[model samples]
Target chain A: MHSALRFIALDWGSTRLRAYCCELTPQQELVLLAQASGPGVVKIVGTFSDVLQQVIAPFVKQYGELPIFMAGQISSSIGWFETPYLNCPVTPQAILHSVCERISGQQSLYIMSGLRYQNPSGDNDTMRGEELQLLGLLRRYPQYLHGQHLVCLPGTHCKWVLLDNGYVSWFKSAITGELFDVLLQHSILLPKPATLYTDDWATFTAGCQRALTFPNESIVHALFSVRTKQLFDAYTASNARSYLSGLLIGADVGSILHDTKVESLPTGSIILIGSGALQQAYATALTQANQQSVLITEQEVVLAGFAAVANQTLLPLSCQA
Target chain B: MHSALRFIALDWGSTRLRAYCCELTPQQELVLLAQASGPGVVKIVGTFSDVLQQVIAPFVKQYGELPIFMAGQISSSIGWFETPYLNCPVTPQAILHSVCERISGQQSLYIMSGLRYQNPSGDNDTMRGEELQLLGLLRRYPQYLHGQHLVCLPGTHCKWVLLDNGYVSWFKSAITGELFDVLLQHSILLPKPATLYTDDWATFTAGCQRALTFPNESIVHALFSVRTKQLFDAYTASNARSYLSGLLIGADVGSILHDTKVESLPTGSIILIGSGALQQAYATALTQANQQSVLITEQEVVLAGFAAVANQTLLPLSCQA
Candidate 1:
């Protein structure tokens, strides 16, 4: 069992820290043995080392001093140690070579470097944790490594990564999630009595269709439609909430489709990485835009990412079998 | 003096109320006798009548029960009287004829109707207060009454009204100002310590240029660039704030330019109604978009709007001279 154990993976972000005790089978498949979570870097009351120990205590107690791999904001400027972002057109091997290893007491901890891309237009965009997921995607589906693909990871700041022949060529980021949150909480677009959002796919699809219909219009206009629709169309608070989500997600998807000329690309070439409601919304939006997309759960990708990195850097030669 | 005095014009909105005491000269010119302001409809603690009486006390005491004409949120469903919106393509005469009158004790009050437009695509947009301003524009510059014109009113909700041959053809409202306020106050893009915004024209121009360059991309993506520029390019909080304003304003202007094909229209055909920093920012954005605009102050337009409506509805035939 100890021989089967590989490394502990930590997905630490702004709000939460998720720890996965991972193992590699003889067939080289990654498996999650145990998992734990706690407050993220921003929410930590005590020292990061102390919080880290507390979070991984049970796993450490079971498997003594396994190598720990950390991703996300854990390597941000405010994290335990700041790691430099690797410039884009980066490959998985290039990312593996750039890992910053630190000795924390008796534990060997490795922090993954993020990716930064400066487009031909000289606009700069940076992502910390999603690089590992992209790398994991490459590992899981080597077929993607040989082709040009658009990989979308939806979150607070949704990222659209362009992969060209095994390299991360460039990417764009959208503030869709954060804008939706701020608008829902602070703007007049928010319905009174703050209705909790429920799944209303029809309303959501309508919003997506509205956004798609006006591909050239600023989203600020569509956002105001959320208010006008409620006033003139008798949209309830729940319907408005669902519709708002769809408008934002649809705009995000539509921007990529318009900017990248996704209609000209082969169908199902766009890969979406997210889970649950956001994934469903993006899928619906893509469908509304007449674009096909392949969906992958975020958890699957992140764990596979950690395992792929661990296999390259931590797993012994004997484990290669 | 009382004989020369005309109706009092109230420009009451969500935040504040301003009352303009006016007189029509024998030469048919509108003269401002005095002006006063107080909390708007949303901030009124007491009855609308009490607030109105208090705000217009000096004028009423001086002139002895002059007819009062009110516009803005004061006539909305949430305001003192729920005045229905006049549908487009409506004329100023139609608006005056639709005025809803309510007698408050000894005082007679007339509430001006708002405008609601449904485009050919069946999208709805509504505007209060600005309808009067649009009427004022026609009154102040009768030349605008004969041709196609785009009138922009930049405020919390920026309004774009299309006037065709003396009728308010249709209009579109962008939540640009409200979005900037909400984003600056609540989003991750907000610079720390909450920097007070000052004039940073260079930074603002950069943002406008960026937005105009990406006319096909969603503003959501450009919004994320605000954070990225701060992270990678070392932008100050003030710079970020100014840049954000430009981005929103630019996107708003770009949408109209693209949608209306403004380049095909006569130059300087767009009339901008606003004042202060917002007016300057919008002017700059319009200039950046290569579209010329004529400027009008909010005070001038609202007063003219109220005076125009009053001249039609409240002024007796004896005062027509």
Candidate 2:
């Protein structure tokens, strides 16, 4: 049961595989000295042994198999193996066992379960990457999110999860991103520029403000105004910013904040994940809506989550027990 | 002047232009005789005279003047003549008029003014084409739209206009289309290969219904489920219908139906102007939304609108007295 054993963490996804080598020094502190990423879980198939060998190549030389664990889509049915999800309201034991078969003579491999949420609406739903991010968010802002907190992780399918007293009570996901894409390009709005250029917080915040203020006209008028402005005023492709920000945030607020008392949500903050324009857009939305804010990095949380599972699955028998 | 004179109406904008010619049947009712279109006013500027001659070749032979009138962006500053916009709450007298002589005294032209909507939100917005379409929508459903009515014209910029009696009282527009475009394509769920296939009004209505019931999550999570169903369960591209249906309608309900009595608006139900997919998307939304609906053709409204203006402007004294 060496607490000092180097703990290896992996953040594997559709595109790339990244790993970090971490260990506790004598003062009992975790240090990450090396990290690397390669062509990810999507490229590999039933050849889990070969895929993993390539994935862990960077860290294998430094730490052997002192202790390791993984996260991301790498554990999905299509990735290394079908790691059945743990129905959440999960504890340590609620975690799913990995379906990985080991090398001829090697340390055991354990994969954490992804989370599935039954929409009370009778829709089947689950999330693998974000719940780990939520877990990481809670660890970072434990005191701030003491009661019921709603975190918005914006992306392809933007997720809004409810964290009641640090245990996920209910959560929902929306495909704001996907809907936006099909509508803009394929719909009548094309023949205009392919993209808007105002990639700043002001654009996003103004959009969020519009969303909170007028849920209905917010998106529609916002778009029409872009054409109107371009035709009538000094509008660049940038005017699309306020409209874009308004649609995503406004739609989120519309979908998530129904019958919700603005004053009552736990510490009243929305956490936004992802990076570049998206993070800023969420930040803009939160500030405009006067809701509190927290940002958990998309990459870091996945990394920490892998480490969290590693600490739980591959550490000492006593530590894991 | 012969009130029996054959007439032609044109609506031109940045991307496209269209014209409709109507002859007074022996019965004295306007009947469509011929129609044509090309790259709108912006592109056909230099050849305006030649195109005008070719367009009205039939009418010119029948009547010497061949008086023609245009509307929408044709009257905008970018229009061939730069006819300016009139203030809101205006009358026919207030219309900014521009006259042009094309093809060396070959044809006489008049362009119409666009409407300006100045509301409390400081939205001094304007519309070129749809107002005429709404006028035609009213022409058809005079019983429903004659009184106070809320008109929902969906497109890149969806419009929510309040009409007092027959005149437009005030209106607002949003970029629901652009948001839907960017979000769907560029965001995470872009994997679904189906292009803008028709919407599954059932799923879309469910989404719309979900929006009215739980407005908060309508925008974000509403989209992803479609993709998941497609990816995991082999949901057809048609299944993306619910996504589009939900998105277009869900966003409409979520963004527009705020603290106001979203359940009910003015009695006219929703009057949709855009055609094909956009129109169907709105009809599905209005159905789920429990709103009566009417759709006006893109071609007819713009043409009828030009006729409406021609009725007022070309021979103002004959009708005014």
Candidate 2 local lDDT, A255-312, one digit each (tens): 4665353335645557677787677676766666666677767766565555555555
What DockQ score does model 1 reach against the true complex?
A: 0.64
Q: TM-score for each prediction?
A: 0.87, 0.71
Candidate 1: stretches off by over 4 Å: A1-8, A14-29, A33-68, A77-81, A101-109, A260-268, A310-321, B6-9, B14-69, B77-80, B102-109, B260-268, B310-321
CA lDDT of each candidate? 0.83, 0.59
Q: Point to the candidate with the largest TM-score.
A: 1
TM-score of chain A of each: 0.89, 0.73
- iRMS (Å) per candidate: 1.3, 4.9
Sorted into a CAPRI-style docking class, model 1 comes out as medium
How many clashes in candidate 1? Answer: 0
DockQ of 2: 0.30
